[model samples]
Target: MSRRKKRRKQEEEHMDESWLVPYADILTLLLALFIVLFAASSIDAQKFQQIASSFNNVLDGGSSIMEYQAPKQPELESLPIVEEEKKPLEEKSDKQKDKEELEELQRKINKYIKQNKLDDALQTKLTEEGLLVTLQDGALFDSASAKVRAEDAELAREISELLVLNPPRKIIISGHTDNVPINNHEFESNWHLSVMRSVNFMKILLENEKLNPSYFSARGLGEYEPIATNETVEGRAKNRRVEILILPHADLQP
Candidate 1:
């Protein structure tokens, strides 16, 4: 064989083997990736985290010798706190205001009663119905007659004036009689006498210009509602009376 032929034969026999090193390295990396994936599936959370962190460190930077600072995030102000709006307090009702005014009037009436010293004849009481101003039969009228006495007229006038209110209230003048049978000229029975007495008393009250006549009323309960027993003289006298009821509620007219 010639020398050139021998050289060509030797080159062909010893083909290029440098690619096997890189191929072997690629196979090793693939095997390592498969092993890591299998391990991740089976390993606990903590162990997996640790392994992942170690792998990242090895892949990114093998050593912690160099110090690097992350970009400082812009300083953020705390979110503004928003508060709720508060509501105003509630005002009093019309009924409540009326009640207060009525109470004040009662005090004034009580003071007048105390100063005048008419405890026996004129009596005042506060009740659920209204303020009741009770007058004895003798104080208001003479026996068997519905007319008020001349001397006591001044007292009746004063009471009528006192009844005059800014916002007028319902005024009911009621007359009552004892359990006595009567058949006379002026009065047919006790019922007639009581009715006339209430009407006469209301007429005197209506004389006050300041008071509203529409609010005034007159009624007679002849021997029906008696506070005391009518068997004795004193009890019968007590039973005969007149009541001036001042109602504060506008809804209750009578």
Candidate 2:
């Protein structure tokens, strides 16, 4: 055979049989697959939550986290702590409500006094301690006498009516006397007169069963705690009076 023909035959016989096309196709598919896998695995928890939420929207109406085992029921003793936690909140709410209620009550009393044209005879005040209703001695009693005057008895009845509706947290019926010392037959001293006055006034209030005697208390300042100086007759008249301090129950710190 000719050398050229022999070389041609050898070339044909030794031609490369590599499967490059199939191998390239497989490599490309594997690369694409790995890219898809990386994208799926690299998703953040936020994305996961969003996906779960979306899926839940389409199917069962709950998130994937809901499927996780719920926390075990707390121990029975721990339940008490739950109640304890709620107690202070409830107490605070009650205190706030009570304060508002007392304020409303004060407003009502003032309105009643103003409507009835008793503004001159009575004055309602909101003090740091509580509400105070100061009834001047001349308006409610005879001069230097423990007896509740006939005209003043009507005022007392009116006040008692209001108190019956909304009783004082503690009705401290304090009686005050002028600086002038008392040396009368019925009363030995101003102190005695002051105390007797308070006692007598409290007795009148307690006559109404609606007014709780347990909550009612009486005291005699006896020229002390004067609202005005005793330098003048008018000032002494102002000083000689009965003050009903409606202490708020919420403010009872003790």
Candidate 3:
């Protein structure tokens, strides 16, 4: 009986330990899976792709589960800079063209005034109102008369021809007079004289077929809007004048 019990104990000691090999293999595979997931979470896209390609090469025996690709940072960043650089240059170019046009018109009128020997009676200036051409009253009309002289009428036609070379804009013909009161046979007061003078001058300008009538206007300021004092003869003469204002184009308004 003792011999039989020893045999049974020997058999129990040798009980199968082969099942533990497969269990160890399963645990190792689980650890490898966890390591791959942790590595994927910590790496950038480039490094992750490289690691994936290497793993696929090693595990799949030359067959690949991942395709290598370059990062897309440069393409996304360069597109907007190219598109945003062109707008301000275009706007500046348009403004420059308009400025050049205004300067050219001023030069032409000044040249005309100098060549015709009318510089003493006519003056040209660039003002906020536009190109202002001022003419003394005695140059265009006789005392208390609204009729333009024959030579001055020819000058008006020349000016109108030059003006029509530009785009259509406002042309204001304004008349001013001295402070001396006048009630003559033809005019009731200074107001009537001023208004008639402006109308007649504008009429001569419109005789040029190239000038558009709709763009011209006339204003009579009488003795109220004087440029000089009324206390002296020279000042009074300076105050009696006519002004022609040529406005800038509509798109160039400040």
lDDT digits (tens) for residues 1-254 of candidate 3: 69999999888777765345565445544644554676665567766666566555645555333343332333344545554578667657876776677678889888998898888888888876688889899999999899999977987788778778566888899988998999978998888888889999999989988888999999999999888899999999988888898887766675
**How do all models score by TM-score?**
0.62, 0.63, 0.69
Which candidate has the highest TM-score of all? 3
User: Per-residue lDDT of 12-103 in model 2, one digit per residue for the tens?
Assistant: 77675432345644554454444335546655666555544544443453333323332233356643457878878887887677667668
Ordered from best to worst lDDT, the candidate numbers read 3, 1, 2
Which runs in model 1 stand beyond 4 Å of their true positions? 1-93, 252-254
lDDT for model 1: 0.78
Against the correct fold, how does model 1 do in TM-score? 0.62
Q: lDDT tens digits, residues 88-151, model 1? A: 1112355566667778888888777888998888887877788888899899899999999888
What Cα-based lDDT does every candidate model obtain? 0.78, 0.72, 0.79
- To one decimal, what is the Cα RMSD in angstroms of model 2 from the true structure? 10.4
